[model samples]
Target: MSEAVLETRDLNKNFGALQVSRNINFRLDAGARHALIGPNGAGKTTFVNLLTGVLSPTDGAVLLNGRDITHMRQDRRVKAGIARTFQINTLFAGLTVLENLYLAVSEHLGRAGAMFRPAGARREVVDEAMAALDGLRLADDAGKTIRELPYGRQRLVEIAIALALKPKVLLLDEPAAGVPSAESHLILDVIEALPEDIAVLIIEHDMDVVFRFAREITVLVQGGILASGPPDEIAANAEVRSVYLGEGTHD
Candidate 1:
């Protein structure tokens, strides 16, 4: 097995009297495709936020490639090779696709900010952005603004932006959410095509997306692990079925 790219060691989080996240131990190996799924209030988002440093844990650590990064800020985490896409598309609606991706590249390089100048004018940045977009089969839409593209394409752009950072770990929070079923496959294909060295951790409600994309599944309920195993084992587990899967048709 590969060394873990991202992990939480006995992590916990709370808001005053409300304890939303429990002591959670999770691991994602290099190149591993894994899913984190549960009921709506399962604290999945909180865990993602904690892992990405959007929210600090009340206790425990977040490790990146065997290094402790539990106290690092979100931007530092990005530079350290952790990137994530939100449940909502966070893009500059007026900016062209190329421009948006360039923002990612430039940010990763710690060069000019997206507002300072046209990143496309920077040879190195544009070159990197173009390469990423091309891989997603979205090169032709490079000139289109974020608002002009369909939801699916925008979702792809989100991944492309994350890719621009050259991250060693990618956390995708509902990459296919809000996309039409017809176009959702584009999101999955893009994810499937990513290089195998970057660990991928996805949180999805769509069983089709989860089962198809993840080799291993971790079921979380109330911020704790309900079960963790291969897809077959998760599918056959009675506890997971009753608590999460719930008789849904699965592939």
Candidate 2:
């Protein structure tokens, strides 16, 4: 088998006395699209935090492509090819869409230090920013401030920022949350079109999107993995039914 693009070895985390993630042994190969799902407080978010360095694990290690990166800083993780979007929208609400993309391009280009540099001086950056917007079919809105866009458009901006990083492994924390049913189709399309070379791990509650996009599913319950496999297997797991599905409908 190919090496895992991302792996967690016996990962564990705690919030005070409550263990929120326990022995999160998992791996994603390059090009895999994986989904993580469970009821609220199941420790899904906590597990992602450990992987991304937002929260250190109480025990265990996070490995990126065969290298240990458990203690790496968040920025270092980003530079190492891990990029993520938040559950809530994260963007420069006051800036135009192109300007927001410019910031992302700047981060990728190592120009974040040159605050005095004119945004117009970077032709390559501008070109890349435009290309990213075009790929998302948001080229027409490039000049509009994020706050002026619809809520769904603003969410797309956040994703565009992460895409600018050229991530080898992308972590999307609930990209469909709070989006209108109509607008969610846009988000789903964008996700479906992401580069096939990149591994995608998504933590989302929307079963429709999860089942539609993810090739494999991992279910967590109270800080532990209850079941994992293709969606069909996960849905039929008795433990998953008793702990998570619990009378909820399934596709």
Candidate 3:
């Protein structure tokens, strides 16, 4: 296989006596469409935290393009080509969608300090932000405040913000959470259309979405990997079904 864009080796995390991640040995290759799924308390969020440096592991290391980044700061990790969206919408409710995207694009360009200037004065920033929005077919909503958009569109804006950072790896935490079923397909469609060179990892509870978007699936049970393989293999695995899918568990 090609070198992984992101990797975790023997990763472990502990809160006193309770372990949240257990010797995780995982890899995300460039352009990988991977899903991490399991029941509640399976430590999916904690594992993402470890990768993004929101939480440090008790042992092991996180690597990006073969460089050790376990000790990297969270913001530093983002600057180093890893970007993520939370399970909850994190957009600035009062800001226009374009404005929110402008913040991210400018920050990525190291020009956030100058963003207070009129957008006309920062043409490049505005152009890039609009391009990001346009790529996601959200240009029409650019003038609307985040709160003015529907929840599903709000989630799409969150993704646009992440993409504005030009990340090599994008980690999406429950991108479709709270979206109406009728609109949830929009989320999957957008994900499926993401740039092929950007590795994507999604932590989701919807089985239909998982099966549709993931080329590979990893089942995390009680903070450790119970299974990792192609979607068909994972779908057919008895343990994964019994512990997660069959039980209709949500995380």
Candidate 4:
């Protein structure tokens, strides 16, 4: 197997006496389509936080391409090729879709200071932003403000922003959460169409999405991994079914 683009070594996290992640050794290889699923309070969010440098692990290390980045700052992590989207919408609600993506693209290029200039003046940034939107099939909505788009489209915009950063590892937190059933498929379609070279890890409660999008699934329960394998094995794992899937619990 190839070396993991991202990894955790005996990862652990705690809040005083409560342990949220324990000895969580994990890996995301290049071009991996993986899912991290668990019930509520299963430490899924905490684990992602630790990986993104949003929260520090009590004891352990985070590695990117075999280099230790356990204490790296969040923004630095992004520059180092790790980018993520949140469970909730984090876009500039009042900004047009193009504007929001432009900001991210510019920041990723270390040209954020040039954003004060007219959009046409920064042709490269705008082109890259447009490319991301076009890939997600959101180019038609570019002129609309995020607040004006439907909830589902808003989620797509968040993804577009993440892609504009040109990450090697893309961490998606509940990409379809709160989306109507009728529109959730749109998110799935986009996910399935992501760049083949970028390792994508999705944290989601929706079983259908999880099963369909993940080539490999890891079940996190009580701050630990209960199972990790292909989708068929995960679905058949009694422990995972009992603790998460079978219970029909939301994370």
- Angstrom error of the Cα, residue 20, model 1: value is 1.5
What number of clashing residue pairs does each candidate have, in the order they appear? 0, 0, 0, 0
After the best TM-score superposition of candidate 2, give how far the Cα of residue 222 lies from its true spot, in angstroms: 1.0
Candidates 2 and 4, the one with greater lDDT? 4
- Candidate 3 per-residue lDDT, tens place, 80-166, comes to 999999899988999999999988988898887664666547788989999999999999999999999999999999999999999
Candidate 2, clashing residue pairs? none
**Global CA lDDT computed for model 4:** 0.92
Report per-prediction Cα RMSD to one decimal. Answer: 2.3, 1.7, 1.9, 1.9
Give the per-residue Cα lDDT of candidate 4 at 116: 62
By the lDDT metric, which is better: model 2 or model 3?
3
Top of the candidates by lDDT: 3
> Total clashes, candidate 1?
0
TM-score of each: 0.94, 0.95, 0.95, 0.95
lDDT of each: 0.89, 0.89, 0.93, 0.92
User: How well does candidate 3 score on lDDT at residue 34?
Assistant: 98
Error (Å) of candidate 3 at residue 73 is 1.1
Cα RMSD for candidate 3?
1.9
